[model samples]
Each structure stands twice: as structure tokens, then as C-alpha cells.
Target: LLGVGVAQLADYTQEDLFAQALREEAAEQEQALEETEAEEEPEAVVVRRWLPGQDVRHAEFGPGWVQGSGVGRVTVRFETPWSEPGRVRTFAVDDPALEPARPLPLRRGEGMDGEGE
Candidate 1:
């Protein structure tokens, strides 16, 4: 494995890479924002197919389940069987990145959400 900025895998050092690029990235962002113009909000999207406990995947955030959905947005709590409670994220119901996914079964050895053992 690798440590944070402790080991270098490539010709450049990790610290050196980030330290060098930080200013460049900030400059680029500043310029881009200056050139950008405000845009109109898109229409609300309706995702009636979603229901509580339904498994889903986000194009960028990976697998999760629908916690709630309505008013043009779908809220997902991205947690897996092996993970602690995951973070929640809201997305446009029609957002291209959100999609339905198959639910993973609860394997043995893992409790069904009980209190202190």
C-alpha cells in the first residue's frame, strides 16, 4: 500500500505534485468562473418509480438506496452491507447519473441492525 504523501510511486513526489498544481488549478478555476454566465434552472423531473429501500447507483458515487424521492429530486443514502451509515445525497430525479440497482443480500455474521451486542 501507500502512505499519504509518504511514498512516491512515480517520477514526481506526491507533495510536489499537489503543491505545484494547486496554484494552477486555482487560477484556472478563477478564469473559468469569470467567463461563466448564470443560466436558468431546468424543469423539475419526476421519478415516480423509486420507492424506499430500493437499491440504486450513481454514476459517480457508486451503489446506494433511495431514502426518499419527490419534487424533482431523489435522496440516496450511500451505504453498503459492510459499511457504516453512508452519506446522503440529493439529485435531480432525471439526472443521467442516477439509476436503479439490484439489492445485495445481508450475509451471515452481520446482524440485522441491532443495538449493543
Candidate 2:
């Protein structure tokens, strides 16, 4: 009788372990499915209409002038008092840090220096 009881307990233990494994596998599969769905979701796209000579401000670079634009990029000529030639940097049109700015008065030798143009 004692042997039979032990055998029953062992069978129950094996069954419990199997059920737990199935639960873990199902949880993994569900998480994988959620990840796949997230990947399939379309991302929001922002369309920018930047033109040549457009005034823009950069969060870190200060005032800039839009030189040109391509599919997803914009070339900007930024004003840098530290450098006589100034600096030109390219950035994505959809950059959150770039925004329209009031036009700045052009200095005497601003864009005509031919050094940084």
C-alpha cells in the first residue's frame, strides 16, 4: 500500500512539472507574438518642406540657414561667431531639435566670404 501511494505521488509530481513547462512555453510564445506585432506596426513619418535660404534654429547650434534638402536630409549653414568661416552641418529633416526661426540679418561678409560657402 505504501509503495502504491509513493508511485501515485511520483506520477503527480511528473504531471505538475510537465504542466509548468507547458505554461512557460506558452508565455514565451505569447511574448514573441507581441513583439512581432509591435515590429509590424508602421511608424509615424514627418514630412518637412525646407527650401534654400530658409531660416532655422537648432537646439544646440543656434541659428542656421537651409542650403539644400534631399530625400531625408537637409544641409544647413550655421552661424558661428567663434569661426570666421562659420560651419555647415547636415541633419535629418525630421530632427526634433530643428525648427523654423526668425530670419537673421546677414552681415557684411556673411555668405560672400567664399571661405565656408
Candidate 3:
């Protein structure tokens, strides 16, 4: 009987306290969700433009670019970013060596660099 009385008189015995705590927690969560929803998220914008002196590797003639291209041909000025202009080689746009390539610092962590996968 003593134990039952003590439990009955315990501060935690009030059911309203637990209910209020739950209500407060739920309110906090709802407020957080509302705040997150209210915040604006930026939209993604894509821009594509050809750049000069970019790195390009060809399958036939090897790495080249930085020069320019003309009618029916792409004249790649053979030279790496670290060296002077080597020689200008003309090749068809569909040439095996002339292939589009991703700039340095390629899509990291994708594990899809040169595998062509």
C-alpha cells in the first residue's frame, strides 16, 4: 500500500505532463518543418560556351587544342598547358583523335573519368 501511494503521488504520475511534452515536441517539429518550407531554394542554371586554350586529347594525333579550327577541319595546336605551342595539326572534326573531353578537375568522385563507361 505504501509503494502504491508513493507511485500515485510521484511527479511523473501526472499524465498531463507527458501529454504536454509530446505536444511541445510536435509543435517544435512542425515549426521546424514550416521554417524549412518557407526558405527559398536556388534553381540550377546551365551555360554552355566554347573556351580557348582548353585541354583536349585526341585518339590519333594525341593531346592538342588551344589553336582553333577551320572549315572541314580542326587545327589543334599541339601543346600542353605547361609547354609552348608545339605544331598545328589539321584533322576532320570526326577524326579519331578529335574527341570532346572534360576539362581538368573532371567530375570527381563519379569514377567515370577515362573508362568511357
Candidate 4:
């Protein structure tokens, strides 16, 4: 129906009715565009939670913990959503051996570790 109104408006070169219909159409389209833009927009703010036992390092303290802290330099906090904020530490991302460990166990049992029991 709206398209029909626009087509009719185009047919007449310069009539008051055609001009009015065009103006109405332009306004309707503008309103629809605004609604679409508003709906597509995301929230203004987002929050991320920290967790415990996860591997992490800071810019100064080296590698430490999922543990809590009390110092003023940094306050460690839990990374997961389930746990409370633990603590923050000022650590270096570059500790000599801060990289992830291998999937295998750190060491074998007495019999397994040695050549023979």
C-alpha cells in the first residue's frame, strides 16, 4: 500500500496530494530506520568475571596464584563467574617458566619412575 502511494505520487508532476504522500512516506521510512537501529544496538556496558586455579601472570609479580592478596600494589581476583574475587597481584607476564605445562603427569610412582623397583 505504501509503495502504491509512492508510485501514485511519482505519476503526478506537481500536485499537493502527491507532495503530501511523499512527505508521509519519507517520515515513515525514517521512523522504521530508527527503530531498526535501536533494536540492533548492543548494551552500553559489559562485565567479565575472573576464575580461580587458572594460569595467569601479571606485568610485575611474575606467576603466583588463584590466591588472595592484601598489598596495595595489586589486588588479585577470581577469574570465573562462580567464585568471589580472590586477589590481584602485580606480576610480569614474562616469568622464566610461566608457560603451560604438558598434559602428562609431572612424575611417575616409585616403581615407574626408576628403572626397577
Best by lDDT: 2
lDDT score, candidate 1: 0.77
* Candidate 2 per-residue C-alpha lDDT over 1-117 given as tens digits, one digit per residue, 9 for 90 to 100: 554557658988999999999999999999999999989999756598899988888888877789899989999998743446668999998998998876654554555433232
Q: What is the per-residue lDDT of model 1 for residues 1-117, given as tens digits with 9 covering 90 to 100?
A: 465563455656766899779989999998777656323445555555678889998878877999998887889999887779999999888888888876655663444333201
lDDT of each: 0.77, 0.80, 0.61, 0.44
Superposed model 1: Cα runs more than 4 Å off: 1-48, 108-117
Between prediction 1 and prediction 2, the one with superior TM-score is 1
Ranking by TM-score: 1, 2, 3, 4
Better of 1 and 2 by lDDT: 2
Stretches off by above 4 angstroms in model 2 are 1-44, 80-83, 106-117
Tens digit of per-residue lDDT, candidate 4, span 1-117? 554556565657567787899999999999999999988998664322223444444434333344422232223432333334445544333333333212222244422322211
**What range of 10 consecutive residues in model 2 has the weakest lDDT sum?**
108-117
Using lDDT, rank the candidates from best to worst.
Answer: 2, 1, 3, 4
What TM-score would every model get versus the actual structure? Answer: 0.50, 0.48, 0.39, 0.25
What digit string (tens of lDDT, one per residue) describes model 3 on residues 47-90? 22223665677675555654665555666776544556578776
Q: List the residue pairs that clash in candidate 3.
A: 58-97, 59-97
Q: After aligning candidate 4 to the native by TM-score, how far in Å is the CA of 111 from where it should be?
A: 71
After superposition on all C-alphas, the RMSD of every candidate to the true structure, in Å, is 17.8, 12.2, 14.3, 13.6
Q: Which prediction has more favorable TM-score, 2 or 3? A: 2
